[model samples]
Target chain A: MITSLSVQWRMDEFCELAGLPAECLIEIVEQGILDPGGQAPEEWLFDAAALAIAKRAARLQRDLEIDWPGIALALSLLDELEQLRAENAMLKRRLGRFLQE
Target chain B: MLEPQGSSMDFKDYYAILGVPDSADDKAIKTAYRKLARKYHPDVSREAGAEEKFKEVAEAYEVLGNAEKRAEYDEVRRYGRAGAGFEVPPGWQRSGSFGDYAGHPGRDFSDFFEAIFGSAGRAGEAPGRGREGGRRGQDVEMELPIFLEDTLADESKKILYQVPQYDSAGRRLADIDKTLNVKIPPGVGDRERIRLKGQGAPGIGGAPNGDLYLVIRLVPHPLFDVEGHNLIITVPLAPWEAALGTKVTLPTLKGKVNLTIPANSQTGQRLRIKGRGLVSKLGTTGDLYALLKVVMPSRNDEATQQLWKQLAEQAGFDPRTEWSKRP
Candidate 1:
């Protein structure tokens, strides 16, 4: 869960890079795919992670034929799966020191 | 995305690419696509050339996965074969109209695909009311390997990577090498992605440039293992050192420090060294764990053997009692 002082992108840049409309970005924000800062769309500033998620969501829509809600769910599950796998690997490595087979 | 060069476009057998027979049904084709896509997806796979393979698969599916494009491509396919220089039959007019059915605009298809399906504006193309006169450049992503020791402090690193350049018509020209002295912030985790603004491919026309995303890959340390921000090091101790407490000099990211091994400490015991792991951009530091592992002498002399025998008799300890009780 280590994070840095991320660079932020304005709404126009976010939309341009993510290849999604403002409404779609609003929908994604509403659906919790991204948690960009600011109150309104005009003031909204996205980080690199948000842009990456948006791009992935767009790919799911274009390539996998998934809806926004479905993409959000899939991304969330995939992120959780990745975290669990990392934690599992670390735990296994730690356990291996004591339980040699 | 590498189209065969020369006047004639190479024939791309969509059916062959999907590994389906000519008579394979739509369900079978879709199943094959799904399976291959899952296997080759650049985001999921670590296989070399996976991104290229994914683009190929997506292009194949773009045609074969659709009804109209498949039928139209099928008519063209009858006159061509895979890997051979192909030309559309003279006076061959496609009966079906491809009306933007293949919709992956960001992913550019081959010239042959454009020749068959009719060329459309690339996906990244800005509409008439775009902020810039043209579309921004395509974003680039590349792996950046960082040493575990480097994560302990902020450092400047020189990085060189290639960015693809495209023309105004969205035709790939050549890759341009970009060199930058990137300021790597502290405590960057493995697989963490950082974006550099306007560091990607140059924009076409008067549009702004795209960004470059650097994915962090931590190189395996010789002595330390990374667990998130924390670090682990295996500290080897002599049997006597473990039995009777000893002060050992342990290596930290900064320098060496004294660690006190407790009396009768067992193997696999861990002692945490506070604030010695890694530093984050916010000035927060993680702790390092020293894992104890007691090692015996590799070779024993006669006098050493006699001493060991005397100690064994004096100790009278059986380590395998639990193993004997386990069924």
Candidate 2:
């Protein structure tokens, strides 16, 4: 079937795709690792970004053997580091253009 | 121990995969696996083929990490390289099967793994494979790299991926190739996931088929760098251009436009070009930023160097004045 990223998954579907339990997902949301829409679990709507973040969070938790809080902190720091690195790379590229003969 | 096929594939040495000695203890093996896993984990590393390397490492750990599996593997290895005609030796039964690279998005095990451990008993035979008396299909994931220009319009991308095939009894035969024409939504950024329902592995025993997830990866553009929806292009300028105002042709994703570099503009200064970047899902356009870079001639002749020296003496600019602010 032809599909796009406009797919917004609910709690149950998100759980299955991410291979995570409901409580763990709820805990991740509580830890600020994921911020889905709506007020409650049943009413929650997770967009494409939320699903990707959830999968990444699950991997971090599983492979690194980190707790929810730790995973949250790690995700936050990793996001910051990625942005910083991108900026650095862009600057370096610009510098190379200037320094090049 | 599982009964081997008539002709076996190359045997993967778990010890070699994990980079541990044959006589390495559990602690040593665990340490080695952890070090390699951290180095090669797909999520953590960007090294080419890191995921494949991590898969091998994880599969190795699945056996070596367990005492029973490791012992069984060791005994099997003692029988020499079972190449053409190999047997599992009578009276030994394959107990449990390994996971599909535990905790990975893609539920795929290698042919070597299947031949050695046998496919994870599907159809309620294994501990967790079955759901409601039948096994649910494995989910498939593939990376889809889209060009930076693709974010502007609703484009259709043709993708080819393989879906795992299983028989009625849940023994994996081989993967069947599936081709699809996927329509990508406009403004999908890097790392966005598109889910296609019931397009993964086929279900067995009336179970529901798995969903396929397409992970978006934005291809790097030669002329522009992405910052969210906005694009940044470094504008190269000579020393005279920075001093005196100039109009130069700048390239955007849409087309070429004339950009004005204001007089006395400093290096690294950004000039904003409104509504010249990527289109957003909400039908709004992002602005592009033109970054200024003052480049000098690599090799200066006597006349050029003399002119620069004269300009420096006349300019009387000391950039080091900021150093005096330190208390």
Candidate 3:
């Protein structure tokens, strides 16, 4: 089946892929690092984006020695920075189209 | 960092991997590790082979990060040099022992590390070891580049990658070559990673295989720029065409379509072509934006210059009025 963005992994599989325990995933969810679809962990479904985010959170905890709260704050800031950069580039391209001599 | 010479194990240059001098203090080593880890960590960096680079850095820090381990490694490092594999002295054995595993998941230390630390606690001890109690294999990740057109429909892609194999004792073995045919569902975005279960390295003693993660990278298109599912194409227009609107044939992803440029259309004007963009996984097609760009003739003849001069004088339009105003 063509299931790229729509593919959702159950909690156990997500934990295995991310190399974290269920408690860690819960901490991440509680800290707002990821929001899997369902309300309960057993019924929760995590998409590809959540997988990437979970992995990043784990790395920050292990590599940089950052705590969960610190990682959550850093991730939100980094995401914001990426969004601003994309918007800035688009705006520059649009302005260049008109300002060209 | 280490290259095997003959029967002897190759000596690794941990200093070179972490880009630090032998005299670097603990604080300096930690700083370098943090900087490189941030740069090469696969989760954050889009650079090619960043994950491998990160592993090398991590291994270096694992040895140098601890004071006792660094002292022991330094003694052996004095007898060895990078790229020139030397046999261990007949009676020489390093004094430091491998620290108890802190349960770092999915990380495998290099063979050189095992040679130095004397493989007390190695790969096979991971949580999901083989079905017979050996650790599961390591996961592998690679980037997959796809064309914009390829994302329009479901397609099968053939990929070839190397998977690390291990002996029954969890000793590192030569990498095994593997090929797979995977179906890429439509609407994958740039940098999105898809996980394939049991597609990574084979586990020792029939343990569950590791997963293979494919990170999608969208190749830059020749004609279009992607914003979400929307496509933007810049259309060049002659001065007269911009002054007096004209219909022109434009190229779409599938075929050519006639686009009517409205009269007095200025540069930077955008015309939206509905349902001509990429199809999302939700089955919704986005709109295509045709951005207008007015261009002047490369070489203006005397006659053309005279005609332009007359029009410029007659129109009496101040193009720099906004710039001329004192804000």
Candidate 4:
């Protein structure tokens, strides 16, 4: 039920939510692996969704030691898998309806 | 873009002067500069005007070294008159020459060279002037390629990294043998960098040693392709196995596991085995995804071909029916 607009987390909170170590998250930010958004009048902020993505990114870096490009590839594949799973579920639902009829 | 008014100074067209095209990127500019600099450097060249030419080349780099100033100069040159009676636009203050700014010391550009690049030079001056001490030691980067299987298992490995150490004369010495046991956590992929504390050069006067970064690279696997915590394996199934539901042995990280193929399992269908994927740091295991690849026999003798033909005829199913509807 938690949406990006409803949730706001600081650096530590964000790391904890993302299931990433605080030191690892700090390293990622320092190495430009993750952009924490710059300060400005209309500054970009890391909402809950962004924080989740950042955590996923940190996990990929920690687990795979994948560079940015490789990390991008892995994330894309995961996204595709999620999409496929949703589609499969939808198909199964439709098939169940057909069987009932 | 407004044109410059007054001060008809004959500015050197360094890009053209160096025989490099205007649209050349930084690499191209550097290449041209090196070729010209080496040829015209006072110590190297004995030709007349070689020193002047070298200074001019150095001047061009002084302006072009910076991105913002180079952009402004390029704009002005393309639109504004070079040696005509044109005054600089309003609010445009000529602060100081490039040489006065000392943008790049040791190789000083002449005063004429500094005038155009001066404004751009001023912004970067504060940081440069404030910085104390000579140049810091260059950061060293090394790549360590590991197996996907090893990463999944969180294996500790002994890695030999060659790092540059300075002698008494400050000369870069060859890579000294420094072996460290690096513990690779599960799920590491290519290009992940690991930093070693004080593993780099010995800094001067008890200064902090530069860090040694280890970039991770994953060795390619023959059968498996890792996707995050999930392990993707193309399971080759026989035609009979695909047609009829059967329990078949599958290759997994921890040896073979029997997998049930649903009736009429089609190609590209994925079967997931729960908690059989790569192990995470939190002791949670991801699912293993088995992608079905119904492999057909490439070459079959008379008996095998006849068997397949009979089986195909008995099935009475048109696999191409869906494809025919596309048109």
Candidates ranked by DockQ? 2, 3, 1, 4
- Residue-wise C-alpha lDDT for candidate 4, range B139-236, written one tens digit per residue: 35577888767867757878776666544333335556677777776665455555554665555434445545566776656656656677777777
Q: For each prediction, how big is the interface RMSD?
A: 5.7, 4.1, 3.6, 20.3
DockQ per model, Cα: 0.30, 0.46, 0.42, 0.04
Residue A60, model 4: lDDT of 49
Q: Which one is best on TM-score?
A: 1
TM-score of every prediction relative to native: 0.86, 0.76, 0.84, 0.50
Best prediction by lDDT: 3
TM value for model 2:
0.76
In model 3, residue pairs whose N, Cα or C atoms come closer than 3 Å (at least 3 residues apart or on different chains), thus clashing, are B129-B134, B129-B135, B129-B136, B130-B134
Runs in model 3 lying further than 4 Å from the true structure: A1-5, A37-40, A84-101, B1-5, B8-57, B81-85, B94-103, B121-124, B324-327
**Judged by DockQ cut-offs, is candidate 1 incorrect, acceptable, medium or high?**
acceptable
Ranked by TM-score, top first: 1, 3, 2, 4
lDDT of 3 by residue, B7-66 (tens): 587678999999999999999999999999989987677789998999999889988988
Candidate 3 chain B lowest-lDDT run of ten = B121-130
lDDT of 2 by residue, A5-78 (tens): 66787898778766677998999999988888678899888876676688788777766567999888878987
Candidates in order have lDDT scores of 0.79, 0.77, 0.80, 0.60
- Which candidate has the highest DockQ of all? 2
lDDT of 2 by residue, B251-292 (tens): 998789999999999888999999998887788989899999
**Share of native interface contacts recovered by each model:** 0.14, 0.53, 0.31, 0.00
DockQ winner between 1 and 3, please give it.
3
**Candidate 1: where are CA atoms >4 Å away?**
A1-4, A37-43, A89-101, B1-4, B8-10, B23-32, B45-49, B88-102, B118-132, B320-327
